[model samples]
Target: MHDTERMNSGEIRAGIGLALVFAFRMLGMFMVLPVLATYGMDLADATPALIGLAIGAYGLTQAVLQIPFGMLSDRIGRRPVIYAGLLVFAAGSALAAGADSIWGVIAGRVLQGAGAISAAVMALLSDLTREQHRTKAMAMIGMSIGLSFAVAMVVGPLLTRAFGLSGLFWVTAGMALLGIVLVVALVPKGTGALQHRESVVAGQAIRSTLRNGDLLRLDFGILALHAILMASFVALPLALVERGGLPREEHWWVYLTALLVGFFGMVPFIIYAEKKRRMKRVLGAAVAVLLFCELFFWQFGNSLTMLVIGAVIFFTAFNLLEASLPSLVSKVAPAGGKGTAMGVYATTQFLGAALGGILGGWLYQQGGLGGVFVGCALLCALWLVIAVTMREPPYVTSLRLPLSPTALRDAGLIQRLLAAPGVADAMVVAEEAALYIKVDTQKLDRTSLERLIESAPAMC
Candidate 1:
């Protein structure tokens, strides 16, 4: 591989540092998911509905603020935005730790979501890495999130068991502090925020991204996926304790088992989806799996063995969809509209979490675990229908290349790029002096594109 294709040590360091930042932040957010339902009831004035609100309150703020934070980074700088967000998160954690009531926990969760720094963090990662290696750097962040979630499921229960919910909140606050240290001491500074169309949302592109039918379907899909996940968790922990005969401390074993089995089970399907170019088919199948799991849980949740089976199946589908959805968004996104589409996608995802938490709590109060399961089943069914009807996504990856002034003026540049093997779409932004193209990497003729750039005529 060319040196350009490989990430240098600086890039590697940046990627690792940023990934840890993401992990720490996400871990703080996720560690409460499993414990809150069972333990949160002890808080004064706790109700199922209020407990659910507390669980998902952060998502509401996160959804609302993520885009603005990204834009803010462009103005004030990435590190400053990150530092401020993390501090806000720490403050929220402290508030929750000291609160004796469910309402206070909800307030804390909202504050936690206020630390909407994901976009800023991603923007910084883009600044620190080269275009060719950008995908790999982003992938590192994605993998860190997955790993943190898995760890959170196990650790949340253990921490809550040992130190209670207050202690858990305190720990999350400490983790947020640790994240600040990582940012200050380890993460390399970027030169400045660059308008990376592929990575940063453009305000003008929002309407167009929202209007895209395929992208909208994907947005709905993520919303539904997370909605189902949040709703299921609202009842799942209690079900495990009440019906599955599992003790609180042993809950980690269930998550650990389910995550392990589900992760391993999801690998081959992911391979099939990517290698066989069967993304739509696999995605629909996963939704169908989710629907089946919900129905299964509704019917057989009273039994320990059956609940475990349902969880394993649910996680298998959940992990697959989680891994696949972002890839689909990337593939379906317009040449220069990826950032906007993803911004919308992310917003919808958080909205789903908020809706799910509230809906799940209400349902749990109305009809207990069965109602929650039934509600999720309906959501899965709707997502499955949407998945089946969506258009097959083009299997292409976006690439951004700096354009020389001569090349920018070349009228035939786009046609030439589209003519290259595997090239599907091309756009040149004169203002930015950049060319954004989508290419099927498996068949892309890189040398031809390089030659065209190398041999471009000079201006008269």
Candidate 2:
């Protein structure tokens, strides 16, 4: 039958290249988050509201076009879509860099966001890797994103100080060009459109995913998390400059220290949730902490010490919630619907970013820092109420095991497979000739499962 070897050289190369590509693009977006609110005032016609809109403008286009771009990739090819996206991103960076007015920057940001290739990129990653090693490949991409965020937090201010905003945009443009070269030179071409049940969204699954309460809840969680994040950044940088008496150049220290504290504080809870299967508890607690951080900042933001404390708490919850929401979505999605579920989840996330940017700007204009924090507090409180009712996610992992077309039609065989030790749920996709199984690895018998799969006839 099938080769079940571990990840080989090609898979590793593709994973690393794609991860870098994603990181470069994200870095361009994130590098503005920490300094934009304060430095943006220097632009012509800049206001608190327009600054927020410019900060989040990319996400708006990204949300609207991701799925359509994914569909285009299916028709044309992944590399073409990816190349076009990078080019658009680079052009947008250049436009924003040269802009003299906030409106020009907004246009550039909108163009930058118009390069929506996340779905295409993820699909290409699925094509380049085997199902067994896909999770590890995706993990690499996720790690790259986290690394980009950390680097951007530190580098945003540094770049602003050293090169100015124009320089930062020029650098981002260069990075996007570099990403294009990496794709052209290093990334392997996909064979064709492969139906990766875990990665490619099926149109039919959308309705089902929407109907899933648990998955919907996870969707809302991601939306709220990103919303709070964007909204916070709108006010946070200005607060640091005005209330904490920190210069724009010195802002990185607060971010660096807070990120470190938050990272360290968040690990134990993540481990506990995974090890003990107490995700609801950890998730709820993180939400509560988010609420507390918002209120704490609203009341004591004038003091540097209190501001630092609030940031640490804010990021701790942010990191934890960000990591956990995707895992819960995977767990809650019905078998064969993981890709659709994630597509919806990602859409909600980008929508939140767009909403957050606009709302943060409007609120800041209306009530300054106090208004922004109060709005975020309410968002967190609502999430907390939602989190309290979420069911504890089961301890299970997805496996795409080989299945012949004939066996896929055998309901009796699927029933028997589900009855097997450690097997929690199983659904066979006949078109793909694979069984998407959710199982507890702790009690699974790999040898027996392999034998059963191998024993099936190749044809009807």
lDDT for position 123 in model 1: 92
lDDT of 1: 0.91
Per-residue alpha-carbon lDDT of candidate 2 for residues 1-460, written as tens digits (9 for 90 to 100)? 2346778888998999999999999999999999889889999999999998998888899899987888788788888999999999999999999998999889999999999888899999999988778899999998898889888999989999999998999999999999999887888877787777788778778888899888888889988888889889999998998899888889999999988888888999999999988999999999999999999989988978888889999988888888889998888777778888888898899888888888899899999999999999999999888888888877788778767666776657777787788787888877778888877778875666777666654554
Q: Stretches of candidate 2 above 4 Å error?
A: 1-5, 409-411, 454-460
| Cα RMSD of predicted structure 2 | 1.8
The candidate that wins on TM-score is 1
What overall lDDT goes with each candidate model? 0.91, 0.88
- Per-residue lDDT for 190 in model 1? 74
- Backbone N/Cα/C clashes per model: 0, 0
The TM-score that candidate 1 achieves is 0.98
How much does candidate 2 score in TM-score?
0.96
